[model samples]
Every structure is written in structure tokens, then in C-alpha cells.
Target: MTDCIVVGGGLIGMLSARMLHDQGLDVTLLDRQEPGQEASWAGGGILSPLYPWRFPDPVTHLASLTQAAFPSFADELLQETGEDPQWTQNGLLVLDPGQWDVAQAWARRWPDVQLEALDQPAVHGCEPALAEGFDQGVWMPRVAQVRNPRLMRALQHSLVRRGVDIRPRTPVSGFRVRSGRVTGVITEQGELLAERVVVAGGAWTGGLLLSLGAPPIEPVRGQMILFRGPPGLLSRMVLNDDQYIIPRRDGHVLAGSSLERVGFDKSITEAAAQTFREAAARLVPALADLPIEKHWAGLRPGSPQGIPYIGPHPEVEGLFVNAGHYRNGVVMSIGACRLLTDLIMGHAPICDPSPYRIDRADFSVRRSNAN
Candidate 1:
């Protein structure tokens, strides 16, 4: 029998499957569609949260652990799969001078987080393409980003090479529960028997868990636009207000995004595209002249207070959950995978798992049968 059956083949699910397999567990990963084509591929790949201080301790803690593990994780992927995710350490520039004090406080709270106040000239020196009027900003030197699509591809390749049973287009319809223990997963194709099952479904996690009596996970659609520009036009990722501009190594400048609670609709609207375009132009005036290469949207699995459910189900034996990461799925994947793996293997976790426990009061499922 498969030791573990991981539902949802996004970054979290794929990584969790790989981690479980590495620990000598026979693993099978199931996805509704092709793996890594959802929010995991659509993200901007920022290694840290947009405003680290704004989030609670749980979010920041997971992000910190993931950030520290990313370098080695990327290195290992490169060594194994010979595919580079283009992990770049160009840092992030926060243009909201109004939050300078708050950002400074965050830096003080975290000794490892390096935040520096930049004058107008310094801002220009870092990203000359930025529009004028940005007099001062916060520069986080430790911030980094990875190409999301490439990272997903590398993980998929690595997982396959590691002998993981990855099943794309396999939609999990329900769970086989005997007494209180989950015996296996009921997919569209057939029953997948396993000793343990993990629900890592992204935006669809809520629906998948509803029958099993779990918390509701909603889909928050985020629209993004890609601008093709000359290389070296924008060197660092720039965040102004809620929008951000990410510059890739290949002269593809990604400007996004609009957080709309529009369910699982991935359709891009003209208004959203225009909004992204304007935001990008504001960040870097030269981007106004650049051609928009693409426009798309992805559904982020949002949760209350932005904390993901990352532990075993309270009442369901042999069932675990790692979904509802919202926008930080890419950034928090490594730490989350580690935590879930440790829990499944009965090993002491590298970090405290209390905050991410599924049984937390705030994370309780709303369904009547959830208890």
C-alpha cells in the first residue's frame, strides 16, 4: 500500500510528496489538472512576504524558515534535475515611505532581517527606471525571488526522478473513512489506498475537505501582467502599496497584482490589466513604453488571518492538511514541507508546529460535522 497519498499537486503537495518519499514512505501525488500550473506557477516568487511586519508571528516565522532553506533547496534541485529555477538575491524595495517607521521596527525585531532606509538618490541608483517622486524607501537586502514556473518545473522533474507517483489530471472526489480513520482517497479514476492522506489542494482544498469536515478554504483571484523590457531596466523587485514589479533575468518584467475575492475564476479583465499596467508604469516609467507580453490570473487559497492549516486533522485519523497558504505558498513551501514531513514521520519538527496546527481555534472548520 502507498504509505501516503498527497492530494493537490501544487508546490506544497509536490514538495510534501518528495519529502515523504525521502523518508522511505511510498507516496502518490494527485492533482485536479496538470501539476504546478495553478497559483504555484502564477506567483511572483518573492521569497519573503510583501510586508513582513504586517503579518502575525506565524506567517513571519514560516517565511523566515523557508527563506533560509531556499538557497540549499534550490542548489539541491539544480544538482539533481539540472534545471535552474533562477533564484535571484536582488532584494526587495518597499516604496511606501509612510511605513518607514513600521519597517524599521520590524528590522529591529528580527536581527537577521536587514532593512536600510534609502534616500531618493539611492533608490534611483538601485533602480533608475523607477518613476521620480519616490524620495525615500525601505530596502531589504536579504530579500530574494525565484522564477515560479521554473521552480515548479524543477521540482516536478526532481520528484519524478525520485520515483514519486505523480498523477496529473487526477481529481480527488472524496476520502474513504473507516470509523474515524481515513483509509484512502477516492479519486475520479479509482480508489488510492494509503496509510495516511494529506490534503494540500490549493484553492480547491476547502471543497475537497468539506465532505471530510474541514475548514473552508476560499479562492482569491490575483491578476498579473507581464511586460517585456530591455535587460537591466529594473534590477530589484519594487513594492509600492499593494502592487509589485518583479524583474526577471531574461528582461521580462512582471507587474501585478489585483487581489479580488472572485472565487476560482481565472479570467483576466481589461480593468485588472489596466490597473496592473498603471501600477507598473508608476513603479518604472519606462515600463509604460514596454509591450505587455501576457496577462493572466491565478486562484490563491486564502484563509482567515493568512495562516495556513499545516497539521493533521483533529478528528480524522491518518489525514493531514497543508493548504490555504494564500499568496505565500511559494515562499513558505520549504518550511511547510519540512514541518509536515516531520509530523508524519514522528520526528521532532525543526520549528514549533503549534501556530500552524489544524485544530487552532481560528482555523476551525465551519461545517457542522467538522467536530
Candidate 2:
């Protein structure tokens, strides 16, 4: 029996397995498909939340705790796997007009988070690639981004190097429970016993645990469009409203995304691609001329108010969860993984785990039968 079995291979699950293994626990990670090719790879890899002040306190708190830790984490991965995640502090330019005051207030409240106000010329100065805008903007100079695909590759290699048994193409049917505690997981291959099981299955988490009664987690599809521009064509991450553009170290510029609660559909739509094109042109006129290189969509584990449930289930003694991070999965995984490990090890937590606890009376999951 493995010490812990992580039932997903995206950013959250892989990280959870690694954290568990670091504590001298035997960890096995199972995935239905290729690891990290889902939302973890499809995301723009922006290290900070988009218009973060709008989110709830829990969202902001977890995001805040993980922001500064990303660079070193990426570096550690590079050192271990020889793959550069391309962590760049290119900064984020928020052109959401009239929200500067709110952003400034948030900056003042969170001294660690640095935000600066910019006028029209200042905005132009910050991003010459942007179109002529007659308004104000908020600049987060400390915000960073990574090449998510590379980051995923590095993580896979790192996990393998540390002796994690990664079983891909192994679909999980359900969980096995006995005496109010999980004994193992029921997979297509066979039953694998574990001391603990963490359901970090992202959007599929709800469906996987439905028979076992999980929280309200559903698949929220988000579509993204990528543009291949010159290396210096776009220097920073430009955000105007919900649509934002991220430029990578290479010549590729990534623009995304839409929150469509259309089941587990991963289909690409021309309409959504056109919408991103319009957003790109609106933000940076130069993008209007460049053809879209790729368009794809991935499902996010949408939760209540975008706050991910990240603790043990109420009724299950040996079960835990670390999913439901709608758009902030990439930004919040560091803190979430650390918190999950802390809970599993029964160590002093990095932050108050109440906000993310899933066992609240109204949201508890109780299963009497041992399947």
C-alpha cells in the first residue's frame, strides 16, 4: 500500500504527490490521460490573479502567499530537471479603467503586493505595443509568468527523479471505503491501497466523487488563443477587462480565455477565437495583423466564488481534496500543495485551513457503503 495516492496528474495533483513524497511517504500518481496536458499546460501561466482585488479574501490570501515563492520553485525545477520554465517578471498592465482606486487600495492593504498607477502616457510608456488608450491603468511590476508547458515538463521529470510512480492512462473508477475510512482506490487495472487519498482531479473531481458525495465541483470550460509574435513585440501581460494577453520569453504571445460552463466540452469555437482576436486587437493593435497560431480550450474545476476546497472531507477519515480553483489554479497551486501536505502530515499549517476546508456542515460528503 502506498502512503498516499494522488488521483490526478495536473499541476495540483503532481505537486501534492511530490510534497507527500518529500516527507518520506510512498506516493503514487494516477491520471486518465497525459499529465499536465490539460489546464496546467493550456493556461497562459500568469503568476498573479487577473484583477485580483475583485476576488474574495481566501482567494487573495492564498494567491498572496504563493506569489513570491514561484520564482524559486521554478528555479528548483530547472536545477533538478535541466528544463527552464522561463519564469519572467515581465509585469502585468491592468487597463481596466476606473478600477485604479480599488487596486491602489488593495495594494496599500497588502504591502507585499506592489501596485502602481499609470496615466495614458505612462501606459503607453509601459507597453508601446498597446493601442492608443485615453484612460488610466494599474501596473503590477512584480507580477511574473512562466512557460506553462515547460514548467509541466520540468515537474514531470522532477517527480520521476524523486522516484514517484506515475501511472498514466490509468482511469479511476471510484474509491474503496470501509469503516468510515478509505481503504484504497478502484482503478481500471486493479485496486491500489493507500493510507490516504487526495482527489485533485480538477474538473472531473466532482464526477469521480459524486457517488461518494463531494462538494459542488463542475467543469467550467475556458478557451484560449495563441499568437506568435516577435520576442519584443509585446513585453508585458496586458489586461483590459476579463480578456488579457500574455507574452512569453519566446516570440509566442498567448491570449485567453472564456468561462463557459458547458459540461466537459473541450471543443474549440471560431466565435471564441474571434472574440480573443478582437480583444488582442483592442489591447494591442499590432496583434490585429498577426494571425492566430492556435486556439484550444480546457476545463477548470469551478467552485463557489472561485475558492478551491482543500481539506479533508467531513465523513471520510482518510480522504482529502485540492481542487476547484477556477482560473487561479496556476497561480495558487504552490500554496495549495503546501497546505495539503501540511494537513496530511498534521504539521503546523502555513495558513488558516478553515477557508479551504470542505467539511463545513453544508458541504460535507458522507458515504456509508464500502465500494
Candidate 3:
């Protein structure tokens, strides 16, 4: 029996498995498809929250913890894999603070976070290409970004190098439960018993839950477009009302992300692409003529309350959940992994995991009664 069986090899799954293995646990990771191709890779790689106030307290705490982990985590990944994840501390600019007051309010709620106001010339000084804006914006100096694809590949390689039983293309059919405790997981090939299981299956988590007689986790579709623009189009990440621009070192710009309620449809629509293009051009007019590099979509697992399920279930022992990160899966992986690790190891977590427990009384999985 493997010490731990981690389902879904995305950022959360991979990190959980790695942390467990580092602690001398025999860990195995199972995934339906190649590990990072899901929401983890599909993310824009912005390491900070787009706005502080949009997230609730739990999310704010999680994001704050994860942001602190990026610098060291990026360095560690590079040292282990001999590849720089291209993490840049370029800070984020809230283009219009007046319109961003809701976010400002959220930031104010959290005294632990640092938010500074930036003047027009300061924003221009940081990112020269930003179009002349009406007023000042908020500057999150510690905000950063990463080349997510590079980080994904590096993490996969790093995990493999550390002797993790990384199994790709392994589809888990369901969980094997008896007397309220999970025995193991049943896969398409065969059954593998483990002492514990952690489900980190990003968008597909809801379906996995259904197989085990659990509640629903809806998938929200997010579409984004990539652009190959001239180097130095925007120095730091620029946010304007509904859109933002993230420039990479290699002259590739990641202009994106529209929140759509289309369930599981990964197809890129003309409307979504135009929406991103128009938004990008509004922020940086030069993007109006930039070559469109790629257009794609991915599903983000969203819970009813927007907070992820990151602890053990009340109905099932030895089974833990770590999904429902929504738009912040990449940003929250560090804390999510830490919280899951603590729950599995029976140690006190750095922060209370009660709010994010899988079986919160109010959000418990409803059972069917024979009428």
C-alpha cells in the first residue's frame, strides 16, 4: 500500500505529493491526463490577486501565505530542476483605484497585507508603456508572476527526480469505501490500496465526488488569449476595470481571462477572444496590432461559497479534498498543500482549516432519501 495516493497531478496535487514524500512518506500521484495541462497550466501565472478586496477572508489569508512562498519556491524549483521558473517581482498596478474601491475595501479589511498608492508618473515609471491614465492606482510591491508552463514542467521533473511514483494518464473510476473509511481507489486498470487519499483534481473534482456519493462542485469556464507583442509593452501587470495585461520576458503577452458559466466547454469563442482583445487594447493600445499567438480555455472548479474544500470529510475518514480553487488555484497552491499535509499528518495547521473543511455543516453533501 502506498503511504499516500494523491489524485490529480496539478499544482496542488504535485505539491502535496512532494511535501509528503519529503517527509519520508511513500507517495503516488494519479491523474486522468498529463499533470499540468488542466487549470494549473491554463492560468495566467499572475502570482498575486488581481484585486485585494474581491476575495473573502479565507482567500485573502491563503493568497497572502502563498505569495510569501513564491520567492523561495521559485528558487528551490530552479535549483532542483536547473530551470528558472521566470518569476518576476514586477508588482501589480490597479489602473483605476476609484473603480477599484471594492478591492480597496477588501484590502483594508486585512491589516496583514501591504497596499500602497501609486501616482500616474509612478505607474508610468514602473511600466512606461501604460497609456496615460486619469489618476493614481494601488501598487502591490510584493506582487509577482511566473512562467507557469515552465514551473509546471519543472515541478513535474522535480517530483520525479525526488522518487515520487508519478503516474500519468491513470483514470480513477471511484473510491472504495467501507464503514465510513476509504480503503483505496479503483482505477481503470485495477485497485490500489493506500492509507490515505487526497483529491486535488481541479475542474474534474465534482465528477469524482459524484462517484463517491458526495456533493456537487461546479466548473466555471475561463477563456484567455495569448499575444506575441514587442518587448517591454508593459513592465508590470496592468489592471483596468475588467481586463489586464501580463508581459513575459520572451515578448509573449498573456492577455486574458473571461469568466464564463459555460460548463466544461473548452472551446474558444470569437466573442471571448474579441472581449480580451478589446480589453487589452483599451489598457495598452499597442496590442491592437499584436499578433495573436494562441487562444484557449479551461475549467476552474468553483464551490458555492468560492472557498476551496481543503480538509477531511465528515462522512469519510482517510479521505481529504483540496479542490475548488476557482481562479486562484495557482496562487493558492502553497497554502493548500500545507493545509492538506497538516490534516493528513495529524498536526495543527499554521492557520485554522475549519472554514475550508470538506464537510462544513452548511455545505455538507446532501443525501438522497427514498420517498
- Candidate lDDT (C-alpha), each: 0.89, 0.89, 0.82
lDDT of 3 by residue, 1-371 (tens): 98889999988899999988987899999999899888888888888666657667788788878988889999999999998889998878777757446655766777666677777787677677766763687777778899878989999999989999988999999998888899889998899999888888887886786645454567788888899977766678878775888989878888888888888888889998998999988778788899898999888887765688888866788888888888888788898888888878878896889778765443344343211
Cα-based TM-score, every candidate: 0.97, 0.97, 0.94
Q: Write the per-residue lDDT of candidate 1 for residues 1-371, one digit (tens) a residue.
A: 78999998889999999999999999999999999999999999999988888988888888888999899999899999999998899999999878889978877877778888899999888788788899998899889999999999999999999999989899988999999999999977889899999999999987898865666579999989999888888899999988999999989999988889987789999998898888888888889999999998999999877889888898889999998898899888888889999998999997899988876343353565455
Q: For model 1, where is the 10-residue window of minimal lDDT?
A: 360-369
**Per-residue CA lDDT of candidate 2, range 1-371, in tens?**
98999999999999999999999999999999989988888888888888999888888888887887898999899999999999999999999879978887877778898888899889999998888864788899999988888989999999999999999998899899999999889998999999899999999987788776777888989999999888889998988879999998777889888999899889999999999999889988889888788899998889989999998977788999999998899899889999999999999999999999885444443243213
Cα TM-score of candidate 2: 0.97
Candidate 2 error regions (>4 Å) = 360-371
Give the residue spans of candidate 3 off by over 4 A.
Answer: 97-105, 108-112, 360-371
**lDDT-superior candidate, 1 or 3:** 1
TM-score of 1: 0.97
Question: Global lDDT for candidate 1?
Answer: 0.89
Clashing pairs in 2: none
| Model 3 weakest 10-residue run by lDDT | 362-371
